[model samples]
Every structure is written in structure tokens, then in C-alpha cells.
Target: MCTVCGCGDGEVKVHGHKHHSHDHSHTHSHSHDDGLHFGDGAAGVSVPGYSQERLIKIETDILAKNDRYAELNRAKLAAQEVFAVNLVSSPGSGKTTLLCKTIEALGGQPLAVIEGDQQTQNDADRIRATGAPAIQVNTGKGCHLDGHMVGHAIEHLTLSHGSLLFIENVGNLVCPASFDLGEDCKVAILSVTEGEDKPLKYPDMFTAARLAILNKIDLAPHCDVDLDLYTANLRRVNPTIEILNLSARTGEGMSEWITWLRTNLAQKQLQGAAE
Candidate 1:
């Protein structure tokens, strides 16, 4: 289980490996008063019978192991000049739709997707429908995709050199921020229908993301959402984060996103060549 979020780390099944299972069990306790105050300790997470020092050590060890796996994943992708992007967002943020539109807009680009969810291969099916090769990873009871899971997913994909690889992470703004999937960058998507204070409420996600996409901008007026406020909040949390406003449904402001992708891909290829 994830000591940070207390989410069960059950079996993680990558597509084509139905019999594979990983059991990650840990002992932790949660207490509720007025609300769950799990962020009061030095480790920033509370667990009964564990001292702050112990908790910190546990978290550090876990992240260190994850980082090692992430480095392996990164090296593998870099060797092929594959630019991987980790798309993260809360549920109902139109992430899958955006990914579909992105694939369509890229035209004949060589790209693949790795879809992550707690259950079902619905999103992966949608991507495959667009005629792109996609692999579905079902993280049963796991809140987010980790480096180890992504690395395994890559083995199933015959990624082309200098192609783009998109990893659509499980819909959760909290735990995904703490996990790295060896992507070149993390893109956090937020819809206008959601609260403008989402950045404030989930500051860690925004801070961790390299870019923030404010999706569903076409419905901003109808949703009574101030686009500027959302941008301001994102900048407040991550001053250096690249922000893009676009609607996948309306095909508006999509050109900018495509250009960003192309530019990043070129840079990644250049880096690989230099190495």
C-alpha cells in the first residue's frame, strides 16, 4: 500500500500479461478528527506506531527505489529518442478526449499510448480506435502508475525511434504527483468545470507538473469560470510551468499544443543524438 495516500497497492496487470500480479502490502493506520490530518508529521504523512523519522525513512526508501526504476525507463526511452509525456489530471478533466484529439492532430506521427486506470481498458480502447497502438495497464487498487509499471508497459510496445509516447495516468491529482513515470515532462490538465481553487487545493500536483493545460476553455463562459483566475492560480503555484488553454472538443487552440509537442520531440531527438 502507498503510505503517502493509504491507497491499496494491489495487483497491477499490464495488457497481454493477464496472469501477472504484484502484491504490495504495508501496515498503516488513519485517524479522523474534524478531518484527516495526515500532513502533520515531518514525513508529511501520518501512520500509527511509526515515528516521524521512520516514516521519513520509509518514504525516502520507496522513492529512491522508484527513482532507480525511473532512471532505467528514462535511459531506455532516451536511447530510442522517444519523447514520453505523462498526462495527469483528475477524473472528468477530458484527458482521454484530449489524447484522442492530439493523436488525430499529429496526423501520421509515430506514437503510442500507455493507458492507466484502476479498472477497465476503456481509455486504451478509445486511443486504439484512433488507429494508434496502445497498451492498457490496469492498476487494481493502485492510485497511480509508478516507474516500474511504466517500464513493464514499454516492453510490450514496439516504439519507433524519435516517436512520441504518451502515458495517460490514473485520474487522481494527489498521488500521481509523487510518482514519476520516466517521462520527459508531466502535463497536468484541468477543466473549467472544476473549481478554480484546484491549484491551491492540490498544490503538489501543479508544482510537480512541467506544463498545465486548462482544458474545456470553450465552456468557460457557460460554466461561469474565469480563465484568468485559473491561469493565475497555476502560475502562483508553478511560476515556470507552461500553460495552454485549449478545448479538444472544439479543436480550438490545438495548433499551439501540437507545435509544443513537435518542438519538444525535436529537442529530445537532438539530445539523444548529442549523447
Candidate 2:
């Protein structure tokens, strides 16, 4: 259970299927029975609980520990010159499909993926079919991927230096907003089939994201989503957030998306070199 979001208490398994020489991918599941219970107010101030100050302290302590882990992960990535991106969205937002398309577009590029889900290695399998290495981090009941979990997930897979690591977060926007997985950017995906007012409804996710991908544009004609209105709503929460409209199915506007990714990656490499 993630103390920050209280998503779930399910088990997390890192599955790395061997596909290459650098691939340490193996089929093994490890259960973590840590005593940290963030859910049910495990902060120890329950029922006729302790003072509000004590409650606040517990929350702060939890976040602080997570932050420390995040910082450590960031340092490790920096040491390897890996540009990590965190993908966050609601369920069925077409994030996995879009990633597969992106991987194909980035053919031959050094890329790795960290797939986060409550269960199933399905997404990781899809990514592997694209000829890229991927690690599946089953978050069990956890709604979001915290830094500590990500750090452990990285340990199981071998990511290339100067490569891009895509961390596909669990399919929930709210809880993921607060947890930092040491990503260089947070890209939120909003499908056209969903309400155009989603940005306003889920302000935390929208505001936390650096880019918002308005996916499924191929179905825009059949859907009721208003592109202009959606953009306006996104701006209301995040004035500087970049927005991209693309349909992973039709490959329309995909060049722009790929170009954006390459540009960011180049910038990251330059920064790493300078450092």
C-alpha cells in the first residue's frame, strides 16, 4: 500500500523476460511485506486519534521518506544519462498503444520501459514485441508507483546509458500526481472519448503533468470532445503545459509526437554532457 495515495495493498512483482545479452530479465516474483501501512491511516493517529499536529507530522514524514528515495533514483539515472518519462492517465487512455507506436517510431534507439500496473504483465509483453527491453512492475493494489518501487524495478533490468526510460505509471491520475518516480517529465494522456472537461475535474494530474497528449483524435468526429474547449480548460490549470493531439491508431500527428520526444531526449543528453 502506498502511504501517499492509499491505492492498494497488493503485491508488486518485477518481471524482466530475457531478450538480449544485457537483459538480466528473468521470471521471478518477490513479495515485499514491509510494515509500512499507509492506508487506513496507519500514521498511528486513528479513531479518537492523536492531535491534528501529530497527524500532519505523520503525513510529512511519509512524503519526506518518499522524496529521499526519489532523489536517490534521480541521482542514479543522472549517473547513467538516462532520460526517464512518467506516463500517467486514467484506465483505457490509450497510453500503452501510444507507447508501442512511439517505440516503433524510435526504431533502433536505445530505449527501455518500466510498466506499472496493479497486475498482469500484458503491457510489458506488448513493449517487448517492439524489440525493446521492458520491466513489468506489478503494483498489486497500489494506485501509483512510488520512488522506492521504481528504484527496485530499475535494479532488475539493465538500462543503456544515454537511453530513454519510459515509466508507464498505473492507470490513475489522482494518486500519481503526488508521487515522484524520478522522471524527467510527466506526460498525461487524455483520450477524446472521455469528457473534454477532464482537465478541470482532475486538476492535480493536469497541473502536475508537463505535457498532455490528447489521444484518439481519429475518433474525434464520432466523439463529443471539443478540442478548443479542452485546450482552454488545460490552460486554466496549467498555463504553460504543452498539448499534443495525436491518434496512435492512424499514425496521424505521430511525427510531431516523435519529434517532440527526440527533441527532449537530445536536450537531456546535452544537459547530461554539460554536467
Instruction: Specify the highest-lDDT model's number.
Output: 1
How many residue pairs clash in model 2?
3
Where does candidate 1 stray beyond 4 Å?
Answer: 17-45
- Model 2 Cα lDDT, one tens digit per residue, 132-203: 888888776678888888888888778788888999999997878878888898999999998888999889
Q: Please report the TM-score between candidate 1 and the true structure.
A: 0.90
Across 28-103, the per-residue lDDT of candidate 1 in tens digits comes to 2221222222332443565677677766666666767788889999999999999999999999999999999999
Go through the candidates in order and give the C-alpha RMSD of each one to the true structure.
Answer: 5.1, 3.8
Error of 2 at 32 (Å): 14
Backbone clash tally for model 1?
A: 0
Clashing residue pairs for model 1: none
The C-alpha TM-scores of every prediction are 0.90, 0.89
RMSD of 1: 5.1
